[model samples]
Target: MSSTQSTAQIAGSGEGGKAFPIPQGMSLSYWLQGVRASPLLDHRTTEQLSKSAEVVIIGSGMTGTLTAYELLTRPNPPKSIVILEAREMCSGATGRNAGHCKPDQYRGFAKYSELFGADQAKKVLEHQFKTWTRVVDYVRKENVACDLWVGDTLDVAMSKEVASQLAAVYNDYKAYGGKVDHINYISDSAEAEKVSRLKGAQALWAWKASTLYPWKLVAHLMKACLAKGLNLHTWTPVTSVSASPSIPAFWDVITPRGTISTPTVVYATNAYTSSVLPSFAKYIQPTAHMCDKVVPPRAYAGSRALQNSYNVRMPGGTSYSINPRSNTDGIILFGGNNPNQALLKAYLDADPNRLFDDSLSNFKPITDAVRDLTSTAFEGWSDDAPAAGIGPEYSWSGILGQSADALPFVGKVPDHPGQWICAGFHGHGMVHIFNCAPGLVTLIQGGTWADTGLPECLELTPERLAKINERANNVGKRVV
Candidate 1:
């Protein structure tokens, strides 16, 4: 497809609001700036679908590409592998995120500990950090040109209540024997503000993190996989999959073009996984998140640029994930949801169909709220509007898969011996997929979850699925 046609298709995909018309000149993401012009942007190995493959993977985002990379690099690789994508390469959440690879060193420890005990909770955090480091090491070893940068990430608490809560969580984490050597906490408001470079900061927790151009990294991986005899078919949405009646032990992956029979099938579709696999309909929900790119004025540019990425916590559960791109002229990638009850209600009550559909339209209320929040929340943010205007230069929403149990479901699909799944990252795919993908490849190669070396909780066993179903059902009832 031509650039104009591609943009138009994406615009109609509902990355913006569907009920409202998209504002004129409202760009999606700065990451997609020169993507259409790149040769790897919409690559397809064959216009016609392959009749059969040894393994068939759905979705061409980071998870699918990485899974393919792992499978192809194995000692005894699959003879034939095919990747099917609904949209352009890496055009999903992987390409639309705010470029943060931060691990939850302590913030989520309390909650995870409460749910799964201290040991499992610590393993979760450890896995996240391991994934971050692995990605950094992979980038270096492969010489991937994705502008990857490792640095500290600030978790700034803007209110006294939040600060106190953070302190309590930190205490709990430490009490549970979670690692704290890498984390530096600042409690005094004065020092917090100075350290975070944000006004009204009551506390700050700094830890190791990294940022990168996600699309570029995934593209490089896709290129490597393609060179290793992987068949990539873009713009081909898999409508359904079923056991092949004629071919015993083989499954048929049905797409718009044709069906590809394979013995093994992996669903890396994430948010859209439920659409194809009805079993995950209740387990994995699609949640929309907004993100934007901002061109900083004189105050935030040049030497004054932010050195660390941030997760600024405001009052009433409001928070923003920020990443400053020095290579892109100090452009700040900012993203979050409004904490207001009304906005949350609107999103929660929105039609599931409209929410899952990918289309771009004007979301003025959200856009205005985010702009106001960013303008007032930051310490030295000036009212001076750059060429792009007072608000973000580009703003758009992307769907993320939220699991019912607040954890990803990785490994084989239950009851389907050859079918497998590696999705439901719950908005933390970048920190989880790198580790999850290799582990999934291990399972696909007849290795046990223990061999993959991932945490046991991540395994998609029958018990886990039953537990999720029980919780979901009980949520509708109450004790009176």
Candidate 2:
């Protein structure tokens, strides 16, 4: 039997699979939609490698699976490669996002320029641009059956404090000679509201983003890798890794049942990366990310579905990324700042929901807040038969790593030979992993620490790590 059971839910609905009475669409995932439309590829349960391979990668989310896929398809493939996952593909944060893909280097450009320098910030943007192109190309070439739409994005500001920030960012990018081709500032709330389908006081629009089905993306990538003969095993978690300067490098990848040893290991576990690299335990911290499904009630069927993704800064001091999904009426992916780790104790203590139902009291606040916001902001939305009218189809929480500098660490573990890491995308994995993984394959093959045009700040060093630790101290806060 497989070690990890498959779990899924309609968006926003609690366990029991009932539709939320909200205005957003259904809560089912696009991946699940695809599976329902077709067939799922076969996979392995926990399996042991009779002997060590040239490389062993842990975690099969976007980062791990993509890394494996890239390595195997490279001009010079590793002698042998193995990928192990703690759960099914896209079972983690990789499957939970809004699928907004963008080379949105601007998101972190201003922050990095302030902390690092203009050169470093520029390099980061350049790197993300490369990654974005690679992602688009891969999705097209691989013929991934996901809804991939390309266009601009909007940053809707519900309050003046946020509008000013949006304006400042827009001007700063322009001053830096950064392209804001699709970015425009609208001072009139009426226009902004109409464009974003959001009730905002003002809005900043940018033209370089796309939205797709995240679960479909993950499944397609996984299928592509499988077709390429990549070896993969699910439910095999790497609990600990042992390495030393004196001893030859070897990784002891632990699973629920057994352990596998390999010469080369890649930690693509993201939020759970610290579990393998204890040295980085203090540097890489896992923070909770959440997404909600909001359905539009039938009364507002006249409103067109949002074409682009949006970031609305709510009056309650939270920012949510809203998009229209293939299944969900509307999806809101939100990030919380400096959230208390203990706040989710109850949910963590219970059994994960197998079906969708919205009966839990503890889960009320988040969906309630989203419902209230949608009711006020969305044009002419009405509550349907569901209690909330656009009730919760499903709401879920996953872990993502925060980098001190808000960039991914995508190279060898410094001073530790034969080990590599590619984690800490900070909710920007799709924006960076395609380019990052290929570059990582080059470094591993060339056996050099050559900078691959990614931000040098991603390098794990005494100084870089120290900065990350300091940032973690203010956990739940956005580093950028």
Largest TM-score belongs to which candidate? 1
- List per-prediction Cα lDDT, in the order shown: 0.78, 0.62
Tens digit per residue, CA lDDT, model 2, 311-379: 666554456676655234444343332122234434433443311111222245556666666677776
> Candidate 1: where are CA atoms >4 Å away?
1-27, 340-348, 383-391, 477-480
Deviation in angstroms for 102 in model 2?
3.3
* Collision count for each candidate, in order: 8, 37
TM-score of each: 0.91, 0.80
Q: For candidate 1, lDDT tens digit of each residue in 106-146?
A: 88787677656788888999999999999999999999988
- Please list all clashing residue pairs in model 1, or write none if there are none: 13-358, 13-359, 14-358, 14-359, 14-360, 15-359, 16-360, 16-361
Candidate 2: deviation at residue 352, Å?
Answer: 17
Candidate 2 lDDT at 221 equals 69
